[model samples]
Target: MAPVISSLNPNHGPPTGGTAVTINGSGFTGVTSVKFGIVAVASFTLVSDSQITTTAPAGTGSVALTVTSPLGTSNGVTYTYSVGPVITGLSPASGSTSGGNTVTISGSGFTGASSVHFGTASASFTVVSDTQITATAPGGTGSVPVTVTTSVATSSNVTYTYVNSTAPVITGLNPNQGPTSGGNTVTISGTGLSGTSSVLFGSHSATITAITSTQITVTAPGGAAQPVSVTVTTSAGTSNALPYFYITAPTIAGLIPTTGPGGGGNAVTIFGSSLALTSAVHFGSAAATNITVNSDSQITATAPPNVGTVLVTATTPGGTSTVGLGDAYYIYVAAPVINSLIPATGSVSGGDDVLISGSNFTYIDAVFFGTAPASFAAVSDTQVVATSPAGAVGPVIVTVHSSGGTSNGATFQYQL
Candidate 1:
């Protein structure tokens, strides 16, 4: 029985074709060969008694495709060999999500383009020549395939991406606050920061140091000691505003009871302007403890262990206080020591004149004999004379007290 020709799945392919073609008909079993025009297909396979599949041999234009069996040859079926349109590139390959932009398509084999398409949406286009077609982009989003179709075949696709034109969004700022002297670099983190045109800190324009799609760094502009808004502008639009605070330098006026013990730990009240926001207090380089901000003009702190005189300073959100400002001086004095008593023995009747000898006798305020108070007179920086008050007829310790602190006691025997 002779093979009978039915149909081809794809009627056409490139002239250099390796197109897989299927022929359908009864009596296709034991097909001796398959041929396109005079050129024979390299190979053929019979799937069943009714169908044979083969690769279309390389040829040009329309050709007669046929199958032959052991019984005879089948009738000819028409198969076309063709080269379809190709798009190598497109001008302005990207456009806004809302399309309607003119795009110049460049390539070859477009003499009779049946239609142009962005993805599945057909678009109106003019076949400029056999190599070019000027088309208007249709509305779309993200990336889509663009292709040209002819009566013979649809061309392989090139991609055209649609850009989202949303304004930039700010997520955070590094070093969002700084001193009023604006020269610090501020880094802004966000999305869609590309193509930034301007950066602003309040009404002042900032110098852009670097920029990218996700981040931008700019030199902040100087402004008043207050809060300001920061923003960035791009081609799409302006970003949302963020806050930046400009702080002033702190100051110190004076300190109450500027004199304390060298061993420290005395409660000292600090008086100054702009003290409400104080975060830390320092005496020279030593840090203070138990800081309390009573008002914008008063602060109390425990003086740290130190000696000699040094300036007291406060640190706030603004800045650390500078030296030579206000009366911030503090004096550190050592406690009075009673190393010996010139007359160790005193009458228990209580009027015993004793000469106290030790270091740090200056600023001595009180003298004590055992548990009783004594009248004292400072004679020198290392000496004090005291008249002992009535005390128990036994051993009584003698000591001296100064603004700096209390001193170690020296034992004195009182005889009856």
Candidate 2:
């Protein structure tokens, strides 16, 4: 029986060929040859008794695709070879010199696009439809012609322009001064900052938190106590430099009534230089409240709750004071308690050496015998020695006083 030709899958392809054509027909078994017009296909596979897959050889225009076997020659099926891709337009005609923009090229005959180019530079591309292709523009400068190439030919009706970018400009910085230790957020306002790649303070790079066309927020990096140049960089160029200052940390020379109750809440007068802008006062890791800046050299703050001795520090825009820098010590002590006294009886004439034993005896300021003040020496955290003062011949209440507070009284007898 003679082979009966039915149809060809993908009846049209580029003129350069290499298109895979599937011939569907009857009597295709033992197929000896397949041809496009009078040209023989070099590669083919007999998929089944009714099917033959073959590569279309290089050709032009429409041609008769046919199959031959021992039974007979099959009737011809029509297949047309197409011209190269045509470029009608580009979605974005201009982009940055650094490139990386996706441009849509629209036209016809794009079925087998081999490459897309911007001038001499080849771009990565994807064929979206028969008339449209998306290509990523490669890095380039100035105006460049865009073209699409198929296996058969190349089209060059569109142009792509590379625009040179403008450098970012820094106009001002909010809260421009900060501690040498850094970690403060600063807002930078400027122009042409849309695509900022980097922000530098002096030679240190700052961490950008937020960015916009005209402003950027960044966390300042640590730097020396001096003025440094701040600049922004983008694909275009580096911006002009602006001044940013790093101030020295405040020093705490002293604190009035440097000792306080363990439960805190005592008012402390802090003396130091660069204290005008004090933002915080810390007892150890706890922050003080109700802070009042009296002058450039003084601040009064209420101590936060704490225990034991802690280094007091004042924080300003300049920075935080370090421990051991000056007289910045604060001792949190529990009130002294007098449990007993060694000599319970003393003469009214005065001068009696008495040993007072109790808890929290360190930093004892004074000892009281009735209404008279007695001299005392802090022997340890739990003991004190005192010389009793003269008092009326009667039972006298003896008490110890410290920065923590006065202790409960113990009765002592004074004899005439």
- What RMSD does each model have against the real structure? 15.7, 10.6
Runs with alpha carbons beyond 4 Å of true place in candidate 2: 1-172, 181-184, 190-192, 202-209, 233-242, 251-258, 269-276, 290-300, 324-328
Error of 1 at 270 (Å): 1.2
TM-score of each: 0.55, 0.55
Cα lDDT tens digits for candidate 2, 285-338: 999999999999999999988898899998888978876556898999899898
Model 1 per-residue lDDT tens digits across residues 1-416: 79888888777777878888888888887788888999887788889988888888788989988888789988998999989899999876876676766778999989778899999877779998999999988888889999998855688999998887877898888888776878888999999898777899999999998999999999888899999999987645689999998878677888878888997898999887777788999999999999999998899999998989898999875668886557899999898877889899988888878999999988888999987899978999898999988877789888888869999999989888
Local distance difference test scores for all models: 0.86, 0.87
Q: Which stretches of candidate 1 lie over 4 Å from their true place?
A: 1-164, 171-177, 183-189, 194-198, 206-219, 349-351
Error of 1 at 330 (Å): 2.0
lDDT of 1 at 133: 97
